[model samples]
Target: MSLLLDTDNSAKPPVTTFGPDFPFDYDRWISHPAGLGRLPDDQLGQEVAVIGAGLAGIVAGHELMKLGFKPVIYESSRMGGRLRSEPFSGADGVFAELGGMRFPVSSTGLYHYIGQVGIETKPFPNPLDEATPSTLIDLESEQFYVEGAGHGALPPLLREVSEAWSGALEGGADFTALQDAVRKRDIPALKAIWNKLVPLWDERTFYDFVASSPSFAQKSFRHREVFGQVGFGTGGWDSDFPNSMLEILRVVVTAQDEGQRMMVGGAEQLPRRLWHLAPTTLAHWPAGTSLASLHAGAPRPGVTRIARDEAGGGIAITDRWGDTRRYKAAIVTCHSWLLTTHIDCDESLFSQKLWMALDRTRYMQSAKTFVMVDKPFWTERDETTGRYKMSMTLTDRITRGTYLFDNGPDKPSVICLSYSWMSDAMKVLPLDAERRVRLMLGALQKVYPGVDIASHIIGEPITVSWESDPNFLGAFKGALPGHYRYNRQMFCHFMQDSLPPAERGLFLAGDGVSFTPGWAEGAVQTALNTVWGVLHQFGGKTLAENPGPGDVFDAIAPVDLPA
Candidate 1:
């Protein structure tokens, strides 16, 4: 992970997710000793509806509960939402991360919670990462191997592609200056550089940025194609080619793609622990009280409808079983599209403009296939070749990226045979888990002609196409060109003082509502913003020393573009 070096002083701050948009210090705000805020005595123990038990809902509920408000969490699906980790049948702890897997160290907001939950993390084995034994890149029926760390280890073509990508970023996006400001947490400088780029790039696509760059323009078409297939950091970003350039820049500037780690057991543990953990420092409730204890060991059933409580002067949430509960305020942490397709929401809850933004929000599709192996056999070196049997593979085949996980010599290992996005993902959307595995195995066999991957398989393979799941609709938001207004509208929805009475009591919080989507840090940041909004609605204020996001929102709010 890169450190923020101070040119004048010796102290170096860690790079955090301090925004290029809002520029709020969420990590500092949450870590403050003074605590988030305090609720009015009358508002203590007042039930607040929190829809969706995902990381956002869980984080918001945990914080709100600490401040003496009773946050009733409603979950239609599992507790972790997209952080789903399905264990292999008959295995001790080996599982497949069907949702989010890799998390960057720069995601301080998320790390705070991961630390809170006491979950262990280790470096993820991305292609070309030091943590990986080796990486095999296969395209057009040709193979190249990268041993050890750094781009210099790659083959000539791949090294050229990597250098060209860097040059393109430097030439087109002022990469160094922007990342330096991000590393230093220079809010003013970050905003100045980023705000200018927003207007210039909001209407452009990531592909457009790459194609038009002087660096890439000088390179051959083959270089651009290879760059797309074996992109820097994680892997192939070609799926995001059509997305707004601003979306890609946000990830690059913040270093979201670097120094990634995976949860020890599963990403789901973070939210699950938060739900059951009874904070040592809490108000209005007993010392042993927990979110689980409040709801009798589980969250309330999935909410089917959300409408204004006309008589109660708040919001009313109706569960799938027809049980309706009223609350002084409500937070919606589910996918924005669900508000239109899954839930029956009141039309007057938001303005037509806000509705347009919500409707315009786009979600991306993703698919993953995994299997538990009998052992870490991939580590075994071939006698003749003097190379590991199977390396983490990235290709232009049906399986875009293949990842391997080694628990230990004694424990069973796991392999993500195929992790594809967009069109690649849709190819196996209708296929069963076994079929998906077969397809991926066939593709991998071409890359590793000698290795028998199926022989070591110990359990039934697990697969997920997030788009097929009604609860999720899609994997995560991928903003298109000209969708900045929609993102800003969702992101700033927490600051609702200027809104009409009907929209005041309801709020939105999740990665989709954040500038950096598909990252847990974004989910945590937005959840904190939701907490501040709920605290403010209940006449609560932060301590003088520790001001909340809502307290200083206007000053550092995201830049606005023409309507």
Candidate 2:
């Protein structure tokens, strides 16, 4: 069922990620004419070690450089971490989005950087989205075709499922009111509804909420099964069914799953551009100064160890080559699991409680297979039924969701043959790209018997199982039931004033540490928080006009549950 509430009022302010947890307007904070903030003169040229060259690290490094600090960025692998866009060999700039493809319009924090870098975006062709020509649903060998968008286009069973989901949200969580509060930026009301839900659902799973809700309980088991496979807004959330209900509510309430767009060229361009682009309005840096210039056009080697410098008064970072450097402050943008598994981090850097939270943080698995095609052959119409030859396919087979990317009419297009999560992802973990492609083609052959997807493919196929990557042990964080405290500890780590002296200068920022994990906006928001934390560490304060997240954190911090 459509979880989005019809609360759009043009006169009202647009809905942004103004938080159900920490309702700080990071978009406004960063976009303020006064700028993010100025650093103390003494700290202007001081180096800050930023680990990982992902979206969070690049954003933090970019902002820190603008504040006149020399941010030394360390990359373990590629530059754009999970915003990976790998180009097919011998293709004309066609990219297969390996990670972080769809971005919601409500993610103002992420868009701020996209706008800054002059990146372009178009509505992603999600299943049954207006941007998509048609959508095919295949469940239990039965196939259904939806020709358009909205609930009206869905089959009766699918529509009933959608309505039930909408009803469940309204009845259980006051969905309309909570979303209205979010759109209107009503902090009190937003907190009133969401804080109440946090305590209720933090200990429950998404599956539990769906099964027990009056709306779903009244329906047949098949209805719930369909909802899991062909979910509202996006395709198949069954993988997340075992996760905390709070996580699902956060996504629905903030519209993080709807009105999504895909970055043109590739999402990786955002970070790469931010690295090379010199902001016109920076504090201590000159006009031409950029992150690339400071780092001599490449980031430092991967970080091997992180510890407090006994000789110096701040954190010390060691590179893979055994080179060590000390920084007055440091920002770690890597996955939390990497802190324990990949990096030799000092045990004293964090309290036992915080360490427990980090060690216990859970991540989800994801896999995607993409192939460059000769043309937009899917656009061809079938003579018998007058339907598009192929469509955005959602199935329960090995290939859970298949997306089609039409570069243009004649130009080479791309198709994501299979996009699966959790168990589905693990099924092909040990397989190579060709084998995965073969299996996906076999599944699609059953759904579209008349068309041959294999014939249209050009260039080599690209596939990735993020769980297999050593640098990133999994796709992103997926908080489990009863893990609210762990999330709170990680999300609030950027506020270091109350932390012990040993952990004061070290900060964490990434999607994994955010309340809404698996979203670029979370990474952006947490990165902005890290920027504010670094400013505070240097004894700097934001201008009165633009008080940073730290300035008003106590008033709007997340609800703290009893230990």
Candidate 3:
């Protein structure tokens, strides 16, 4: 967002998930407009192996390559990672956003790529956007439509639910104080407030906070149920019930779920563009060389093993095809569990404290199913039924949330038959796309008795169970109660000087290791953390006036690990 941009647009926000923002300026890191520091002549040709061609890996490689280092990226699958955009069998310019669909403006780090890449973004058909002119909230045989959240007056029950959540925040955490600190970017105040509450909330679940908070306690348990069923912003909070209260609070205070937009074509376009974008100021290589150009338009094979190169060399990586190469530095952007489960990583590569953090990180489950229709028939209003043909729906039925994507009135449109998480997702995990669509359509039939949804489906359905993907294992990290120390260890792993020589050149990054998982902001920011770290390892330095993150990390760093 422009909130962080300064008069000359050479600065960045002063808030970091790992702590208060770095004392140094971000503009110092980027000599070029894209944000990068120059590597010394001696460090120019150093090879930096980047594993996983996801956002974190891609961003790290893209930036490092700009700084004159050779960043060869490897991937087990496609380049976009969780930003998978699948199209119908015969349709063009139409797709099902299988993962990481909506993005909020608060995600300034990600917006940097989006803006530079020049991709068009439109309002996602969230609860309240131009895409969703109407929204239906259906439950217990009762149905109601609102213009959009906060657009018009809310129903009595929803009003009570909203007020109760507000009250709960006020009573439990002093919501206004924290929110003010967050918005004002008051690092000291935020640390002072958040540190005290972290220990208390680290041991508490979201449900525990809701149930025990004075606001919800005064009202019956029904208030909590109502809040879970239809929470403010996206939808239900129930899926996050098992996560630590700190997790939910971070999301809430940051408002990463609010006022978001979706890329017009597909969210993947940004990363894809970055891969092919030949920056004007690239060093060492030819002026026109891009990551795609350097890799010959294809990523290297997936990494299978990582070891400390024994002959006083840097790190050694072995890919799936049995090719082993040594690089000065390696950034593992793959999921954390992959380090232990799939990769043959040496135990000494990480401390037991770091290993515990990596191994115990919890991930959430998510599923989404989509189908293309002949047209946006939902825009039609039935004279007899007294309701628009269909609306962006939220329900308590088998299909929890259904979204409508209108390409145009006459063009093929997409409907997310069901976008469920946690238990709701697991319910349909066993079913194929067709069967899931059938079940979702059947469920929708119950909600809108006379509506004929199946007849409008013009093409095949697309579905995803992120948990089923071996590479991801689960959607994203959803830290459980008491996992704060693990998170702290993981988030701070970029400071390799604190580690022994055996683990020094290996860096950990990705949304998985970030403090705010499931958000691209975390991925982008953490990847930048590694870029700064790797640069420093190779004797790179930022301009003295605009120091980089690592230049003063110790002073500004937060998350003091527990003894």
> Which lDDT values do the candidates have, in the order given?
0.90, 0.91, 0.81
lDDT of 3 by residue, 1-563 (tens): 11111123234333323232222233224444544667889778788999998899989999999889989899998998998888789988999888888988767678778887898887788764555777888877688677644623567777777777777777777766776676566767877777778887888999999998876887877678877876777877899999999888887666676767899899888778999998877789888989998899999999899998998668899999999999989999999998998899999889998999899999888999999999999889878966787888888887889999999988999999899888999999999988998899889998888889988888778999999998998899999999988988887788888677887999988988887899987888789889989998888876665566777787567557467
Ten-residue stretch with the least lDDT total in model 1: 1-10
Tens-digit lDDT string for candidate 1 (189-218): 888888899999999999999999887898
Rank all candidate structures by their lDDT, best first, as comma-separated numbers: 2, 1, 3
Off by over 4 Å in 1: 1-12
Candidate that scores best on lDDT: 2
Which is better, 1 or 2, measured by lDDT? Answer: 2
Q: Which 10 residues in a row give candidate 2 its minimum summed lDDT?
A: 1-10
How many clashes show up per model? Answer: 0, 1, 2
| TM-score, every prediction | 0.97, 0.98, 0.94
**Cα RMSD to the true fold for all candidates:** 2.1, 1.2, 3.9
lDDT of 2: 0.91
How do the residues 386-432 of candidate 2 rate in per-residue lDDT, one tens digit apiece? 99999999999999999999988889999999999999999999999
